[model samples]
Target: MDIAARSPIGTRLNGLAAALGDGLRTHGHWVRAAQWVVVLVYSVLIVVPAVLPLPDETAHVFTHLTVFSQFVFWGIWWPFVLLSMVLVGRVWCGVLCPEGALSEWVSGKGRNHAIPRWVRWGGWPFVAFVGTTVYGQMVSVYQYPKAVLLVLGGSTVAAMAIGYWYGREKRVWCKYLCPVNGVFNLMSKLAPLHYKVDADAWRASYGPQSALQNTPPCPANGAPNTARTVRIQPVNCAPLVAMRKMEGASDCHMCGRCSGHRDAIALTVRSPNTEVVALGGHLATGWQTLLILVGLLGIAIGAFQWTVNPHFGEAKQWLAEWLIDREVMWPFAENAPWWLLTNYPAQRDVFSWLDGGLLVTYILGMGLVMGVGLALPLAGATRLLGPWHTQRFYHLSQALIPLAGCGIFLGLSALTVNLLKHEGVPVYWVGDMRLLLLVGANLWTLALAQGVCQRYATSRSRRWLAQAALLPALALVNYQWALMFWIW
Candidate 1:
């Protein structure tokens, strides 16, 4: 039992957790109903805005559905959804995601085929995330309604199609293919709430049961006995997690379908560092590290910073000047379709081929540089810990989740700030808030690094040396953020 489970305050907390878990179990139908409601709203937001004309300079979020959808989708919905993953695991994926719900609903009545081995490939999350991030930048997914429909709506369609082809009643798309699945999985390791499974109870309940009924000879003992069947209803986990083996919140969607099964699983509280510091050495993988170091910290930062960075402007100008002097005119043409590149004429927001090419280059360049910069120190720390241990290297990478998650949140919330600023809202506190979050995230990550070091280091000196090796990576991350928030 957990030490906290013995105290009065802990007892109350446990009771609250149990009640919450039981409520979900009992009111699952209500959750389904709520999911449908969200689906309706999501559909309207995605579809209705695409058909409407683009909002003009005089148009406000309140006055125009297109602008309102932009604010809702980018400014509020996505940023808060990212925040929710760290707070409560993937409840959004389980209960409120229109795509997940729609995909599963379609899958229930569709062909229930065996999942192909290629479909089960583990690297899809990282590949899909990078693909979508780069493509979204190329098309300006955050700015235009058409781009939102293309990127987000297109993802929904693919989800349903994959569901139609894959395992019955399972979130195969989410488990393997969703663009944000890797991000959510990385951030969810820090969630305070998760479905806690009691392994001992699971073993006891699933063990062989002996019963006597009529007259059957027992083997070897020569006793008369009969076998009686005992049945327990199986849990239908849509994400297809093994309830008995689940140790972290990364894969479980928190749907509560298996809660209280055989008096074992329950929603419970835990330290946010528990998974990263303890289980990460065993569970961490190279792909997850790539998603953190490259995808989130590298690609995401570049995507958010390019528009605001003066270097992008200078580079584009230099390229344009060279192109003009060389008499190359095609790159200057804004003839690309809105579906391919951001070409919206009336709003005067169109990306020429030069713009699109440079955007991709800039984002990828940032990703490579930042990814290499961050990886070096982690690699150093890993080497300092001992001779090449791949698991320990990946485990140390887990310590950066707090900073990576915070950086992404801050980037998304920057859109929120820009949208509100356009609405004439005062946001004087945003700067201070950003600083506080950055400091807090850095401190949290440092503490997690220390805890992880404690697990691997054989001596006190070795531990301090390993931690010292990590300081450069922390400094690099802080410098990147400082450039965006302070220097820029």
Candidate 2:
């Protein structure tokens, strides 16, 4: 071991990591305790204000945006959750996710049906993500407490429903159907902490003993227990993470159920790109490419930027005028119920059909434009980098995951900052902070691009030229973000 790993603090941290992994694996009581606590706290927080009446705006006890539910949900929770993914991967999904917990708790009592092939579809996560994003906007989910209960609460219920019907084990809803699953999976790649498993050590230690009398031990004999810890069998991994092929932080939710099974898993610190760079074979897929392009780099940017962008008003007005000239006026009617759209006439808050249509077009058009901008450069990158084809193009697109990940974070953070500002909290430095983050994320993208090309491009010239091809995509994303924050 290196000097750093051997140091007292490092050793202590390692010990703690081992202990945490074991506890998560073996401490069934503790896990249930946490789930119930989350259930209680989140149930009250999400359900109460949504069902109850909103506080009277004129009755002034607190300042602007005194609605505690909205403040907590939007201002604090959303932004910090995104931040946590970057730092600790999907610890939220594994540990304190009330939705996941609820689903699992309900699923335990439900039938263990055979998982169908449709449930294993690769495009579900991407489709779900875009659907949720568009729907959330349509219903003003982030702005209203009731919308929160309606949308997020509906999702929580759906998770339970799906889990109740599908797979005998594993969080089927989380693994396949959750809108945020793909987002969390992508963001988790940037986390520095992961439980690394040595397959060789694992097999050597307990390959023969994998099937204990009562399924004792772990997945491949990894996650060795410490002296105070009793040897326990590894339980089924909830997210269905494969130990044999566990290469990145993408799939593991850090649940720790499989921590000390084969006595091979150990928590270790690494650079953020450890997984981004280590992802072998196919770097990404066409679906994944769409996710980064249309979803993250494109729609995410447009989603956060449209209201702030002056062009939105011009476009909306032009469309309105065109529709009026054509004598099609019904689209302007804001008659949709609040449950269907954002029609709270009492609060002077209603979204016309025109508004909903314009929003979809604006976001889709922005995404299409950005995706094209990226695709063209990436096409060049593929040609420069390899005996290129559709799959290779998809593979090479992984180079920009850093950029995509950052765009999503910034977009969400924008909403968070807005909520704080509404409550009269000072977020004066948000613009500058965004600029710094943009620059840092861009630099990280460039570095990752360089590394990817060097490792994959076969020759020195190809490596350099491939990186050159990726430059424009990086530049295109940076330009759009700059236009959003700095210029028109």
Worst 10 residues of 1 by lDDT: 206-215
Over 4 Å off in model 2, which ranges?
Answer: 1-16, 26-28, 55-66, 206-232
C-alpha lDDT of candidate 1 relative to the true structure: 0.89
TM-score of each: 0.94, 0.88
lDDT of 2 by residue, 377-484 (tens): 988988887776786677667768777877777777776776566556898898888888878888887776776676677899998898788888988998888887
lDDT digits (tens) for residues 1-488 of candidate 1: 34246688766776788778888888999999999999999999999988988888888889999889999999999999999999999999998999999999998977988989988898998899999999998888998888999999999999999899888888889999999999999999999888998888776665544223223577789976545544676888998898889999999998888888877788888788988998998999999999889988899999988888988899999999999999999999999998899998877889999999999998898889989999999999888878879899899999999999999999999999989999999999999999999999999999999999998888889889989999899888888888888888
Q: In order, what lDDT does every prediction score?
A: 0.89, 0.76
Candidate 1 has what TM-score? 0.94
Cα distance off (Å), candidate 1, residue 479: 1.7
The per-candidate count of clashes, in order, stands at 0, 15
Residue 106, model 1, lDDT: 90
